[model samples]
Target chain A: MPWAIAAPNTPPPPTWGIFTPGTVGQFFFVIVYSAVIYWLISRAKAGMPVPEIRKIAGLDAFDEAVGRATEMGRPVHFTPGFYAFSSHTLAAFSILAHVASLCARYDTRLIVTTLNATNHPVLEEIVRQAYLEVGKPDSFNREDVRYLSGYQFAYTAGVVGIFHREKVAANFMMGWFLGEALVIAEAGALAGAIQIAGCPAVVQLPYLVASCDYALIGDELYAASAYLSKDPVMVGTLIAVDWFKMFITGLIVIGVVFANLGSKAFMNFITK
Target chain B: MRRQLPVWLGFIAGMLVIIARYFAFPGFTQVQKTLDNWAMYSGAAAFLMGMINLTIVHKTNIQRRRENWGASLVLLIAMFGYFIYGLFTGPDDKLFVSIFNATISPLGSAMFSLLAFYMLSAAYRAFRMKTLEATILLAAGLIGILGNAPIGAAISPWIPSARNWMTEILNTAAMRAVTIGTALGAYAAMVRILLGIERSYLGGRGD
Candidate 1:
């Protein structure tokens, strides 16, 4: 029925109140999963022990990169990648805040570039506050936080120009990078900058890995922020997500086993 | 209140959209259209944010007489010139289209074309058999690269089959893992934001 086309004059189907009838199972699943995560997070906030998150090498290199920038008397370059209000952008901002704070502490010049038009204003404020928090409010320069270009390739070109011109000692690229990841990263490599890149963009992961000195793969991009900030709430969310992933993996294996045995009940319930 | 208001609004609007998907009521379509329009208008208005920041940044550079500040001046002039031209002649005018096609389009393509050379350099470094993992990765990559190229078929028939197997089986499995991990991470991040647990966007002082 979902696939079938209705007659031109036919009346539309009736609604199933506020929740879709077929998706009730999905809604329930989400709610249950959320509840579990919420409970774990609450427990974590209460100072209960949660499983330790893996030590992400790329995240660990952030402080080293910042230190290197400080020692070399060169600026640190950061980009949140091309994003317009996405989860990846949010993750990127957390790292930006962390990096900016470190730069402020080290009295190192920090240059943050954004390709997304909307992110530019918010990013400026974020870097400003980060400097303020580190007691170096006067160090935040407006010129350094540039909104290069809204277009992806133009942004890449602009970033490449910066790497060549400014001669940044350490470059941190964390966000929703895509095809231009390599172009910018390769420029960083050529400039002899300690390049650390992270993105959940799997298609571009290989490129980042190839070009960057350190690459955060898969969920590491999301987890890196928590690792850097060491915020209880962020850490709690990270831990909860790992457990949920394991739960989903279990479900997937069970589903596959049942499916192989010609049992379509689980699939039917989800689809229905 | 700075963070709370926006967070509350986002949560309410997101819930409305989610709820709207279930019910095909008489007025649901109109509500969806209204919400979509508001989002579109907001996104369009964001271009102004970019313009203001661009002006501020370049203006500072020019004031300080920073290195290559001339480029910033040129950018400002070019941007305003284009804006004035579009304002008077309309954006759809032949001149406007001609300028965009001649300059902007080609410049964009030029930047994109540079990616090929960058890719070669990156691949050259990555494909080096420096470590066990690197060697295995280089092997897999070689299979993928050669299988797609015409020369692979000329070299050996099995090369193409091996490439297809590596991509269709091994690559697909790895891709799925990454996809699922990213989906979960993104979903969890959104949930945290909606619940007001994540407030980095607000530049809040954490407890």
Candidate 2:
């Protein structure tokens, strides 16, 4: 009975208690990456030329979609999907501002739907400001910036209803999404609305690609703010990100090599 | 001041969070908890604002007798009715739970069930033999379907192995690449925001 008892195993104590346990590698990456990004940003701030961003067809279609909506005399519909103050939603806000300005300049109605109540106020402010910036403050309608529902499917139903009722000429789906991605995109397709969808959600990308006229795949959604604004600092940050991606690719290759050689040393080092 | 205040506040909070993540500083956990609680409280307050917005929008529709005014009225009634009832009964009340389970749950499921038809239509549109990429996608999709079905194994052993390789190797590798790219992009965006460079979220271009 005494032999049946097991010894307790615990992690080793932290050295110097400076960094969080098991996060040394992460901290190293953060410092190096931030340093690289800041260096590029400073260069951009000093008016040095940075590498140009490649063309994203989905983003390029923004003006065309807005123009189509204007010519058709129909409202442009946009949803930032269901998220609360995420990076995806922030990117969505930039896109929303661009779309809102286009709508204001064209004197076309823009309808925005939000699943999260928290985003409603910010979205309304963004839309209102966009209109104001474009010298069409009077065209900003508070009612059009709607908070649909917190429930996923309910939001989908509401968006689908709007698509049919308002006869939306163009639909833009941006931000984080779930199962509702395809339903909304397909509903827009059924409504004959030219659709543009973007999200970092991998599982939902195929649906957007198949159903929407154009889709921003993966990091393209993150590239949106820089792509739309064409700000040098943002562009510089994107280039830094590309370099970091290369760094990660290198790590992946090394990890693969170690794995094939039957060694867990690299894996443990990474997890450290 | 109106604009600069938010950016400064954002920078402070973002730095604090980053520090807390990387270092084991005293009181950091408590500060993080407080920040989370503040976020929840802010969300609650925003819910009230959203309620007001809904009422205003729908009330206007009903007052002006717009198209689908009846639907608007119905929506307002249902929303307020359930809200008031929940307020009185509490969320854990048996009747409240039962009502939610009976109506909202089933409705959500029904809405989700519509995805099957949507997927079919989307697949049909995407699988058209128009381009090389489309042809590859169509062929892969057919193989994937066959591999999943029992009849596929009866036809050929290679079909299942091919499907497994496609999903396990090709699909997973692509997914990992996308996931990594997304993480890097998000981190970069966060850096820009924290450094007070990207002010697009504050209704301004990066100035």
Candidate 3:
């Protein structure tokens, strides 16, 4: 019989299988994020009436707090809350940027303490940039940006020490805080620092509200950047997010109505 | 030239990462992976910078014979001790494990427990019936706190049920409203960052 040509039964490389799905998903997420971001930017540029953000008592007090520090001639302590790399921290950074600018403009010393070593460089950059923006780059002191420690309590202790020693006139805590929130807040209070604290951590909010002169509750922290910048993209995204919330609310209402009527189908649909 | 290069690079890299995330293109995906790796490494590298900054400040204080040199010495010792322990000892080592469990763990727990006392004091101060809002907040907080504790259940069976109802109906609703509002705000800010309208992050030198 003539020689038969056999087809190769070799399997595709395992590497290909591993690479494909992850890459695709990542790509998809990035594109969606970009599109939303772009839409927001365009809206901002077009001068869309950025929905008026309700004045947060905490944010309003920021100026007063800074002014108090200036009058007292004491350094203002600012700790951008715990998570160094999170979006919340970035938002906090934006607020810090603005606050730093205010500090520079007022010719007051601002002391920023970072919990994580990794955050130090970024924070230093943020402070420097803020000063530069305010036309006081020369006044941006490297000593003012301190790295306390990575450990939570260690960081808190360091901050409290700074509070007492420096007699911080104002304290701004913005970011992802846990139990240390109250410790720092209480310390600030004891130091007679006009404290403004903003964090998304629900548990910490009450503590902040109680001890701090001003408390940015829940989502107000997220709104800080947009509120400070008045950037259009931020405004547009805010609108879109509201729409999303409405949809969620509608769903909740429907589910509640069906549950009350004892509709198994509706209940099951919601439970799923 | 220095400033412009960084700006362009940041813009291009940022867009690439975003696009790569959105699309399934291999090239884009690779770029993103590379960027992510770079971010991780860069983040790690920042530790050295932080150490340098810390040392500089503390050393300067010591050299200047600044006030509270004793505290600085204690801090330096503690830092070095922790670093040495972490570096040298494996988790399997009894001494290391005990130190972690007994000393570190308890200290952390104690710090967290400290909040309870502060919170009570702070709440007492904040919940003064000064305004209508304050009065409502006080009432809600009282209910919420009682509901969460065991004493509320022991005091009255109905109290727990009432607390549960309040949490489910009122607390949930209020929290949800806040969440929605925050989500919107966050989305807006993210959009600004992506569009490069928020270049204040790049520093004042714009590098």
Residues A16-83, model 3: lDDT tens digits: 34433335433443355547656755766787665554566777777898999999899899998787
Q: Write one digit per residue (lDDT tens) for candidate 2, span B49-101.
A: 88888999999999999998999999999899989999998999998899889
Task: Judging by TM-score against the true structure, name the best candidate.
Answer: 2
Off by over 4 Å in 1: A1-18, B21-33, B204-207
Clashing pairs in 2: none
Off by over 4 Å in 2: A1-12, B204-207
Error of 2 at A268 (Å): 2.3
DockQ of 1: 0.58
Which lDDT tens digits does candidate 3 get at residues B49-118?
7777877888788888899877777767766676678678755778777766887677778777777788
Interface root-mean-square deviation, each candidate: 2.2, 1.1, 4.2
Candidate 1 local lDDT, residue B32: 76
Q: Over the full model, what C-alpha lDDT does candidate 3 score relative to the true structure? A: 0.75
Order the candidates by DockQ, highest first. 2, 1, 3
DockQ of each: 0.58, 0.77, 0.41
Q: How many clashes (backbone N, Cα, C below 3 Å) per candidate?
A: 0, 0, 16
